[model samples]
Target: MAEDPGTALVDQAVGYALLAMAGLRADALARATPCRGWDLGTLCAHLAESLVILRETVTGTPAVRACRPGRDPVAACRTEALRLARAWPAGGDGARPLAAVAATEVAVHGWDIARSLGACRPMPDGLAERLLRAAPALVGGGRAGLFAPPVAWPPDAPPGERLLALLGRRPG
Candidate 1:
């Protein structure tokens, strides 16, 4: 029904990884990103913690710490990318595999980071497009009424831009 939860999960994993790397080195900790006023470093740390949660979910294990904690957040995120590239954890009709979601997250967050750097590419196109298509449901079902602005999306914008615009970031 909803985007095979695994898909979203995996996408997020990938997205954060990309964000961590693609975001400007200086800006990675200072620039504002789509997640509102949170700087790049904070965003990366948040994403890193998120991945740890995903890893626990995928592994179906009981997690003590939600984030990697004290290690270099960026390096921890990069390590996740490497592992996720190798294999995604799967379950529930095989639709919400962790790897797939991780990939999607990586690509989109990469785009986000690129935008912050003023250097975004068009993406691989396919994955970004697919994420654009699914993001509404993924975002809407969970928290549409929670944080979206009173302003709606611009009618003619691309889906990625529209999605970012909705979240308070200028899209690439």
Candidate 2:
């Protein structure tokens, strides 16, 4: 059977995140990331935590216990991503919304990881477009702690750049 669009989005986002994490070295964990005040290690830890939460939500199982990303964050993220992929349900209305949110979280944080490494990896065009379409709904009126104020971008900018700007990241 074909994969659900939502699930596909999550998968793609996870792929993007994993790719961004490919170059991460243990020595670089202390490097600063775009997400103000968060270091690379902290960001990776957050990503791992987010994936576990997404997995639990999708599987409808309460987490047995808190998950700690441990010493090797990259491995932790990979493990969590695998778990999420395996736990993702075949299809359900409830999964779509969670998927959208998960995709956005993973993709944006992936970008953050890349930027932290001084890489200019653009978010894939298709994924960025989809996330942009879902942004307003996912980030309704209150832009308090979750995100910074939206940054302005040229109308002709790439979808990835536009999406990054909308999410308050200064894309280059």
Candidate 3:
């Protein structure tokens, strides 16, 4: 992990989110992701929207408008990522958990995007570790059913795969 886990998380999340979307094509919008019931387009929109909402929650700002028509999910995500990075206070301890949420959303949804795109790129281990530490608090609180029950992973699996398993995502 980096010196500041929060900043590192945001950096990792934004980069991966963008990378995942870069692989998206119009023809693939209807493709299935690892996330059940959500297609590629729907997951991308959710990830983009989540970033903006998370930023507002952490920055004490009013909610911004949802991604409107004529705005692609990738573009919206990039814009919100930049805005969130700027609005986020430096060394704000209270916002650390929010950062974790932002990172987790990006990473998990990045996985969905990548899976749909057949990219199969490895997720950063450090980011996965941070998300794993934050998961119980974020998902166990009132978000119970937000994720399915955790699946088992082999002990020798990579860090990202293990983290996804803990988050109830079955990583192939």
Cα lDDT tens digits, model 3, 29-141, are 78898888988777767777887788788878887655788777666766777677666666778877778887888788878788789888778887777787788788775
Per-residue lDDT of 102-169 in model 1, one digit per residue for the tens? 45456656665566566755554455556656665555645554435524668586655665565445
RMSD each, Å: 5.1, 1.6, 2.5
Clash pairs, model 2 backbone: none
lDDT to native, each model: 0.56, 0.84, 0.77
Superposed by TM-score, candidate 1 places the C-alpha of residue 31 at a distance from the truth, in angstroms, of 2.7
> What lDDT would candidate 1 get against the real structure?
0.56
Clashing residue pairs, backbone N/CA/C < 3 A, model 3: none
Q: What are the models' TM-scores?
A: 0.66, 0.93, 0.87
**Ranking of predictions according to lDDT:** 2, 3, 1
Model 3 weakest lDDT span, ten residues long: 1-10
Off by over 4 Å in 2: 64-70
User: Residue 96 in model 1: shift from native, Å?
Assistant: 2.2
Best by TM-score: 2
